[model samples]
Target: MDKKDRSILALLQTDAKLSISDIAERVNLSTTACWKRIQCLNEGGYLRQQVWLLNSKMLGLGVTVFMSIKTSHHDLQWLRKFALGVRDLPEVLEFYRMSGDTDYLLKIVAPDIAGFDRVYKKLIQIAELFDVSSSFAMEEIKYTTALPLDYTHTA
Candidate 1:
């Protein structure tokens, strides 16, 4: 990507609601040119999707937790089943297949302890897991909905 493309992406990452004209003004480009660049970025798959950052607390999702999962059998078939089970679970906001002691890590949000309990119970019934440890996030000190934009210079 060009330097202008990088700058355009940086601006949008902070606020997707910015008008094309406003973005063009800030990035030293004409409105149409800026709009074309954004469209290219999207069509080229550089920009996947835009999302609204929501506050879990304000939505009554008062509890957030990280679940570290491990399985007795690390076979691929079992993993597929596990993934499918978690795929549509509304409480799980994010899932990561990690490189560590755990096979997967899940970021979950629930209304309260009881709400979380319901999710917890349902998940255990998916498979006979070796370990499923939870670590509640007491406070999210810094949560950024944006990715760091130093990728322009990457080889």
Candidate 2:
């Protein structure tokens, strides 16, 4: 990607609603060229699907819990089952297979402690886990969907 593509991506990352003409003006490109570049970015997988970020608090999910999970079973079948089971749970916003003491990590959002307890009950029912520990976040310092564009390869 060149400087123009980087600029375009930066703009889109902030707000995906910008018109082609608006982006073209900022990037110093013709409208058609700007449109083509966006298409290329999408097709080349540089631009992932755009989404509306919803506030958990406003949506009645105020509690944020980070769950560190350790399991005795590490076989393919067990992993697949665990993956499928967790993916079905709506409260789980993010899941990760980690590289340290914890085998897996899950980010769960709940309305309150009671709601979180329900989620925990559901999780233990799904599989046999060696350890399941959760830490509640008191406050969110900073969160963002935008990625830094400085790391992108440039011409």
Candidate 3:
């Protein structure tokens, strides 16, 4: 990753919809060169899948909740069942196996308190949890998908 490659990545991270010509101009590279570089970045797995971040309020999902789960079962089978149960739920936007007292954490989006309760009930029916706690966000102060590129190095 040279300076030109870094520049291209910075631009693309800001907006994946940018055209190859626009990226080329911003990075000061020829169109062909920029295209090939992007291809290399994709092949090398440095560039992952691009995604659009949606506005929660606009989509009728105004409530954001973080759920902390603690499970008594630590066996592989139990963990697999829990993972599958949560994975099938569309409301679960993010899931992580935590390292602290909580066994897992999930970020859920819903329309309101009733909607969140429905999701919670469905989740508990799938797998028995020792403890489940939810924290609702009053507002989304900041959010972003862009990754800092300063740590990347030219190979």
* Cα lDDT over the full model 1: 0.88
Worst 10 residues of 2 by lDDT: 47-56
Clashing pairs in 2: none
Extract clashing residue pairs from model 3. none
**Which ranking of candidates, highest TM-score first?**
2, 3, 1
- Per-model root-mean-square deviation over C-alphas: 1.5, 1.0, 1.2
The candidate that wins on lDDT is 2
**lDDT for each of the candidates?**
0.88, 0.95, 0.92
Off by over 4 Å in 1: none
User: For residues 1-155, what per-residue lDDT tens digits would candidate 3 score against the true structure?
Assistant: 88788888898889978999999988889999999999998999988888877888899999999999999999999989989999999999999999989999999999999999999999999888999999999978878887888898865
Q: Between candidates 1 and 2, name the one with more favorable TM-score.
A: 2
Once fitted onto the true fold, the runs of candidate 3 whose alpha carbons sit more than 4 angstroms away are none
lDDT by residue (tens digit), candidate 2, 31-149: 99999999999999998888778889999999999999999999999999889999999999999999999999999999999999999999998889999999999999998888999
As for candidate 1, its clashing pairs are: none
Taking all chains together, each candidate's TM-score versus the true structure is: 0.94, 0.96, 0.95
Better of 1 and 3 by TM-score: 3
